[model samples]
Target: MPTPSTPLGEFDLIGKYFTRPVQRVALGVGDDCALLQPAPGMQLAVSSDMLVEGRHFLSTVAPERLGHKALAVNLSDLAACGARPLAFTLALSMPRVDERFLEGFSRGLFALAEAHGCELAGGDTTQGPLNICITVFGEVPPGQALLRSGARAGDDVYVSGTVGDARLALEAFRGTVALAGDHFEQARVAMEQPQPRVALGLALRGIASSAIDVSDGLLGDLRHILQRSNVGATLEVDRLPRTAVLAAQPLALQRECTLAGGDDYELVFTAAPAQAEAVQAAARQAATPVTRIGRIEAGSVLVLVDAQGQTVADHFGSFDHFKS
Candidate 1:
């Protein structure tokens, strides 16, 4: 709960900053529990994501962007499951009640929520280390949700949007890589704000056999699908779609970021070869670009090859909370 020093108490803080009336749910905030009524023939899909001050983001990030990202990451999980956003709950903790910060955070948070028709059903606030956790609820038709275990041999692998931009921005912030002003800003936007592919995921429900969001890295997230489906993949290094900023970097850096960079938030999915046309149509319907980067194969190993079919021999690992 927020301290008493500020005019806003815990209940007042929640009412002022987090409460919102919801139509989809029978009961919303100010109640003991939220009552969500899933649409007929639809199953409730829920996902939660946590963002700490230093571990998930730099403290220098804008409060608005942080609010957007805190919820966006959870929404990305809903997207991976081919679900439609319905409502959400936010659990927020901070050292003190900063009215300015809360104003900006709520603005960004509600803006995205409104854009996706996700209502704020309930949440909690407290005085502690800065942490934002959001649990989003969505809906999907029965047995229609995309899973990581459906990929099969001979399926075409695809990824939505360009990759590696977020990593480039992070490297620049760390002073590990230098970038031009325009390039850094462009990459920084990718890092600070990522669009969840909700429409793309919904569109790919029947077309894509398996799908996962590129939160930890392209290869790492893809490996989950591969492992679950008992399949392997052959990636065409040159086929990866990268931003102009990332493309201008050295081959090693480009590969490193594109393969192992976390926080991209793009969708990596697989569909049967016969569904290629349908996949393109789904992309068009969503108005999101999709690229075919590789093909799934028999076995459980992922092979990265250049245009010449030569294996790339560099080790790249994704971001793990415990081991990066």
Candidate 2:
């Protein structure tokens, strides 16, 4: 393998690291445009995400992990809609064509793609600041795809897996918090290599009334559902699930992280009160744990409450591209 200083041409770079035989797409790399064929009775779900250096990830992250995350974040979008993976196109910009970095990045990206049975289609590469943009394609049956606007007044709000760990990791990286070595590693993994709950999303089809992936934060992402569904919610702050590490933090910190910590790729969804049993069944079938956190209400404001049913003040703000 050549070093970072090696003069690798554009076509050579794509051919050597990004090219792969197509399995799901009608056409793949080496073409002007990739062709896709969605299955009958299904609607195509498309989403794209961009990650910039020093903004989306730290400068010290391993290339392989960065690669995995670049795709994982986009797949999280598809999971929110209960769509099955199909294919993706990668558009990358880098300061230079470093063979070592390309090797590790492609390895991480393709590994996750193969696990989801998603193939690489066609895309472009250019010389610039390090940036990764991926456009993913998925399919879901008509009328079965989950949306943010489906929650009702009586729907139960649930979140799959845990939240706040990624924010904790980010705090550690930023020197705002201190953590033991192993604890930092665990949280760091949660931040860098989030597992998209595709299986859980698939199982929740026809079960979840509304759905959104926890990319920005639980409270922030949940607001999208509330606004779109025209409903309010009373979240039991103490009931928000967390790992033991995060649980050991201060009460205020724990609430802030769980409520407003972004980068946790878990799913936050709503379902009917009558479908509680069905929701549990779906979780069991998907091998993911889900916890009921709150209930949707008639108003248009989100209220936070303690375990004792006291209304708590809302103060934390989630990640905003411009504000943060």
Candidate 2 overall lDDT versus native? 0.93
Task: Tell me how candidate 1 scores on lDDT.
Answer: 0.91
lDDT of 2 by residue, 97-117 (tens): 788899999999999999999
RMSD (CA, Å), each prediction: 1.8, 1.4
lDDT of each prediction vs. the true structure?
A: 0.91, 0.93
List residue ranges in candidate 1 displaced over 4 A. Answer: 1-7
Candidate 2 lowest-lDDT run of ten: 1-10
Index of the highest-lDDT prediction: 2
Clashing pairs in 2: none
| Candidate 1, poorest ten consecutive residues by summed lDDT | 1-10
